[model samples]
Target: MTSTAASRPGAEHNGFTGRYLLLLVALIWPAQLLSVTGLLAGNAQSQIAVHFHTTQIAWFVLVSSLIGAFLTPFVMRAADLFGKRRVMIVLTVLGVIGDLVSALAPNFAVLLLGRGVAGFYAPIAALVFAIARDVFPPRLVGPASGLIGGGVGLVALFGPFLSGWLLDGHGWRSAMWFLAAASAASLVLLMTVVPESPVRQERTPMDWAGGLLLGGGVSAIVYGVGRGSDWGWSSAGFLASVIGGAVAIIAFVVVEGRVAHPLYELSMLSRRRVWSVFLATALLAGTVLSAGTISQLLGLMPKIPAVSDGLGFSATKLAWIGAPASVVIILTAVATGWLARRVDSRYLLATAALFAAVGYGLTAHFHHTVPQLMTVGIVSAIGLGMIVALVPVMVIEVVSPAEQARANGLQNMLQGTLLTVVTQLFFVMMARDGRVVQGTQFYLDAGFTNAFRLAAGFAVAGLLAVALVPKLKRLEEAETGEAAR
Candidate 1:
């Protein structure tokens, strides 16, 4: 009788789509505001330069990511300590203040500080996924993960367009204010509608030393890569920063291997499946950042005077061209969750990566036409869409529910770190000539095509990683055993 009742189809067996929808609705604006910061920051680079003021946009991205990397693990643990609801509320409040500062800052330095402080909400990435895991049943974890992850795409859809409009009309200040309002709304909705996730009782010390070494290492590497173009790849400063960062990371691994209450368990990382998933994540992150770079370049690169192959697109048109990518991502993200249940996720991953690879390959080849760019945009977007939705689900499946929040933080941290590095690479390569390419003109340069080629290569590498994922089943089983302890 107990077994029969447990197996019965009811709320216990099914999932809460309504709850998921409510959370998604609540998150859309906050997530959008957070993400649009980069777009606005990047757009302001040229504007700042025009007024005889200059600062590398790469620095802003680096600082922003570093703030998140250092704070995420600690913040998630705080969610456990003080309660996820309480911590989320505090973080959202801080984010609003940061946004307001960015909007009103009179100088670039103040703006950078504001942006970094606002970035404290970076842990919100893990908090959202953790909530999804808590609310949904086992069967619906994938879709729930997808909905939470895809919420970013919802924000991306309008963020780029809105950012461009604001930049054109009211300057970057308007966009910053827009995000501030969005953040305020998210805080209210979360307070009024969302409840704390049920707690798991445990006594674990926060890993302070590990966080410092690992966070510092990642920040150094990201900073080096981002500044490499400005300082030159061979410069002493760049090389030292990169090497120093690498050493810090090596130390972190050694310390984590020995720590009783490690921020991230070294044993878990050694599991073949977890590492394979991490590898795919790094590549996918690189691809996503690279694609964004390509899109920005497309807008900046000029038309091929008499030829029709190259575009001389305005920032607004560029946003329109890129908007399809976000749209396709939304559709695929929603559908991929259902597909994961029936199909081997590894197989689906391989196939999706192939789509992205083909799209990027086509993009590299068809440097001339808008229609061709749009079609390829859809292709890669579909693959990227699958990635953002599925990667975290894979992590949850590979680990236990108790480890979900920390693991989610690690996955996000890894992706953010990779994205920071990739964006830095983009900036450095663009700055090599010491002259910024203006208005669709860089597409005519060889660097633009090379960047696309590099993005395709990462997608191809991801496909290869996906092919090897099933081989890690033993690792997954072993991880489950550990989590059980």
Candidate 2:
């Protein structure tokens, strides 16, 4: 697929019917909904803590992410070997099971296990991207990718409000049942409507060692970071986990370089554009996740006497305020897909970084009222929408069709890993020496303020990464000219 050939509109070779594409999008929607529901439900942290114990709430929220980060690479490879459809069915089944377990759990440990099972759904985005690239015509690729990427943000827009309403009216377990039913519906749709992709590679030896090392390493590091504040940062266990994780990662890299059929291609990281995007992705993931966690905390904070102290809004009201930003995310993502055809992607990324930086910076300083917070969210979401739309497309642009699934899978892994660490750090920042306010049942305003400032710094770092991405014109020209020949 040459750039010119891929970019040409209405070229019908290997194109999917509209219904096929719609079914694929439909199958993807539930996965997106499940992921966002967890984030939105973070607003109920206080309630969850009361039920499960304060020490376990963070684990409950992060367990799914941690499992997802480890499992993504293996799942992508499975799709490559067995089939995308088969893998998706397996994932959906696991999601349904997880949701049921979560809804019925009597203890925090059971809920944690259930959440881990739910992690199977997290990497569906990468598989969806691969399916789009394989089945859709080049012309439709951008739009398809946009929908896959933006779909999450779109659902996430309403996710908070929906979760809030359920929490307020039906309780948290009802939210679990809702997700379970959604997953089951998606499973039915996938089996009945979605077609198997024609793309397949010869079965190769699975990289079990690579998978274990990477997964274990990432889990260790995340656990260390998550528990550091509670265990004392300088404790032996914290130092051991962090160091062991670093060593394991180094070994994984070395082993990958030596393996014939490695789980992930380490060489891809050597490419300037590829590695730059990965870095930017890590920073973007960290910033976005941190900001979101902080926003939830802020929403849950009690209305204090001082205006600058807290908003004191109910979960439902907070959802309504933040809901508009989700709409903005969908709109901006669609626009981003359209814009990528005309504009340089590097320029698009740089602009996105700027929007994020400005949004976070302003929010850090001016979060005194609902309107102000909503405005900040909208601006940040615009940038987030662009990032969500463009990153996967750019990743596709850099790799061949056969490599798309793994590349996207690796991207998800990196994003999840960084997001986990960043979110844990934010929790640490918010919890450090903090007391629960009597009426608010949340942390002081100072913790949120500090966390937002740190989030802005991550955005600034992403800006620098985007700045380093070389101009895309030459690469585009080379791809087009290659096809012409």
Candidate 3:
């Protein structure tokens, strides 16, 4: 059953203070580095192509997504092994380096590497969620985690606007400079403000073999799925990568079964209490994680005067178009995050899934005009806010304090892997009937319809997944029981 770590002495603060606010900001800043970087690239694909003389603009974001999927578990393990604060400092440095590299890159190759390194910042979100749980009392955990979860709304509202403004005024590289300066400031806060996590695991041998195997398997699968569209879905190369990845993952499990010190606690993960959430996570991937990217792409695609039915808006224009939805998410995320402590997460997830299905179904047919897509986006934002606010809370609450990072980290890996595959699937669906336009490709309206339909279908699948989750109680009960002992 779902539960939170029992409250510790002196951790029972009644309200947050300025120090707490500063801590949360320090925790969220590094994560925003990744978000702003991706939005910068995603919203300015056309500009990147013109500036770099290449058509593979999506790679700028995809490479980072792949690295996040591959590296997060190890990073989280390192945090638990060392200290969250120390690891966060190192990550901030890495992210700042990435920001500088991307900003000053003379060629697209260097930019790609820079973005991939920035993906190392991906684990910071999970770290923030875990840290809030560590520092806050049981009563405050849900709302605190919710705010951490809602940090996306903070970035989404501003990232697009800032990226668009920079893209319009100073060019794409200038945005990276902004991220670099912001990251440095964040680094100082992490070094000074955020406390190290108190929950610690006993020292043990590092599971290098299992880590390599797991990373390799996950990396192979993500890469194969991402490239399947261009390499032919049934091509020999695609099959080899997929098969190899599966073999490696299976072998990793075998090795974990026999290891003295496992990279992940497989026995713990397989518990019904935990595994159900992971299943829900996989299904949720197809919902918000999949549909979100599709919506962004459709919103930003260049509108061909007489050739295509795409919306030819610049980053700034697209950001304005999406502003209504961002505001809705900010409201819904706070509400759902608060509700998570009272209502069962399964119900929250179910409601979120249902809303997404309806919004995507509407998007399938009525997406030629601004009002139509805006309506779909606003409707879908309710679900987006729910997933962002509630899912992370559910993930960390299911385990004890010591296992929190590994549990959250594993979920990130699962979520990141599935997101990469599912998003690529949507890109492939729309790209099936695409045509070349001035060295770039644009999908037909019919292709977009098919992809939107598929997105709705995934939302329906998520609803089924949520139905299988058992009801759980508030964290306060768990704390009460611990106090009586």
lDDT at 449, model 1:
66
Model 2 clash pairs are 303-312
Which candidate should be chosen as best, given lDDT against the real structure? 3
- CA lDDT of every candidate: 0.68, 0.74, 0.75
Q: Which stretches of candidate 2 lie over 4 Å from their true place?
A: 1-17, 303-310, 436-441, 473-485
State in Å the error of residue 316, model 3. 2.1
Model 2 lDDT tens row, 1-485:
11112332233444446665666476557547555655655776656666664555777778888888778768988888887878988998998899899889898789889988988787886787777676555556666776777776766677777877877788778778887898888888778866665566677899998888888888889889888887889999999999998888898999898999888887888888777777776678557755787887677655555432456677788788888888998899889888877888888888888888888888887787888888888889988888888876777667666677788888777878888888887777766535644322345677777778778888888889877776553223322111321
- Candidate 3 lDDT over 1-485, as tens digits, reads 12335444445456666666666677667655555655666666667766776656657777877777777767887877787777878878888888798888889999899888877776776677777777665656667778877877877787778877887888877877887888788889888887776665666777888888888899898888888877888999899999999999999999999999888889877777687877786677435755766666677666665444567777788788788888888899999987877787888888988888888888899888878877888887888788878777777656767677788788778877777777778778877767666666666787789888988888888888877776654555443212311
Off by over 4 Å in 1: 1-20, 27-33, 39-52, 300-312, 433-444, 471-485
For model 1, name the residue pairs that clash. Answer: 229-428, 300-439, 300-440, 300-441, 301-440, 301-441, 301-442, 302-440, 302-441, 309-368
Q: Which lDDT tens digits does candidate 1 get at residues 34-115?
A: 5566666655544443332554545655676778877876777767655666787898998899889988888778878888
- Give me candidate 3's TM-score against the actual structure: 0.93
* TM-score, candidate number 2: 0.90
Sorted by lDDT (best first), the order is 3, 2, 1
- Candidate 2, run of 10 with poorest lDDT: 476-485
